[model samples]
Target: MNISEQQIWDLTNQAIDKLGANASPDMIRDYVEKEIANRHGGSLPTEKFEGRVIITAFGINKPGIVAKITGSLAEMEIDLQDISQKIMQNFFTLIMIVDITSSPRNLKEVQEELARVGKELTIKIYAQHEDIFQYMFRI
Candidate 1:
């Protein structure tokens, strides 16, 4: 099928309606969620539970970038386990590691939130570790 944006969206809406009519609200929600997740390629990546999210903030650095970054995590109740930073070339590279809650059963939400903030500033998150180099390039 020649699936266009409009077609995909229409199908999703129809699915939502069918589920709503046949099942409870929770069931519809689950159906819509499953449909959405399937669109992202079956299943999401397995996030590293314990790793650092290194963000480099720049571009006038804005005003509330720092607070927004920390605040979002705070609202999610994700614990800021550790942080490191340095200012160079008028930029702040904040490498933070957060202890995400197990109840959520996923780190994608936290990653998505970080990605949204990155669009506003020069931000990046890398899994920093001594063995990363040895495992990757083996150079």
Candidate 2:
């Protein structure tokens, strides 16, 4: 079965509630895995989960920044769902909603690739799965 982002979020919340505040990362992971397995008749899904990711980048404004970033994303076959950007004086901030379901690279690999691009361009780039982004930024 292909898991949706909402399902992952719900599972995470359930794990937190059941495990409490003191749960280690491993414990939470194991709990979620077991829950998924139990729900799926003792086997985990083999397909990759389809989800969107929020990509944020910020640094001094310069030429070709968007091109460079989008170029890398294109190479990975990640679709850019939407983008918003602002330039204030010499600083620039960009936010993109990307669909990674078709991408060959996973979230971590995409992050690493973006990190390398950021380092080369002297900027900061971050990629977070939509569920994590919502949880972190929720009011």
Give me the candidate number with maximum TM-score.
2
Q: List TM-score per model, in order.
A: 0.47, 0.63
lDDT of 2 at 41: 82
Could you tell me which residue pairs clash in candidate 2?
A: none
On lDDT, the candidate that comes out on top is 2
Question: How far off is residue 113 in model 1, in Å?
Answer: 1.3
Q: What is the per-residue lDDT of model 2 for residues 1-139, given as tens digits with 9 covering 90 to 100?
A: 6789999999988987899989998998899889999888897755564799999999999999999999999999999999999999999999999999998777878999999999999999999889986887896
Question: Candidate 1's residue-wise lDDT over 28-76, tens digit each?
Answer: 6677667656776785435545443333344443466668788877876
Which 10 consecutive positions of candidate 2 have the poorest summed lDDT? 41-50
Taken over the whole model, the C-alpha lDDT of each candidate is 0.61, 0.91
For residue 11, give model 1's deviation from the true position in Å.
Answer: 28
Look at candidate 1 and tell me the lDDT of residue 139: 64
| RMSD after CA superposition, every candidate | 10.9, 10.5
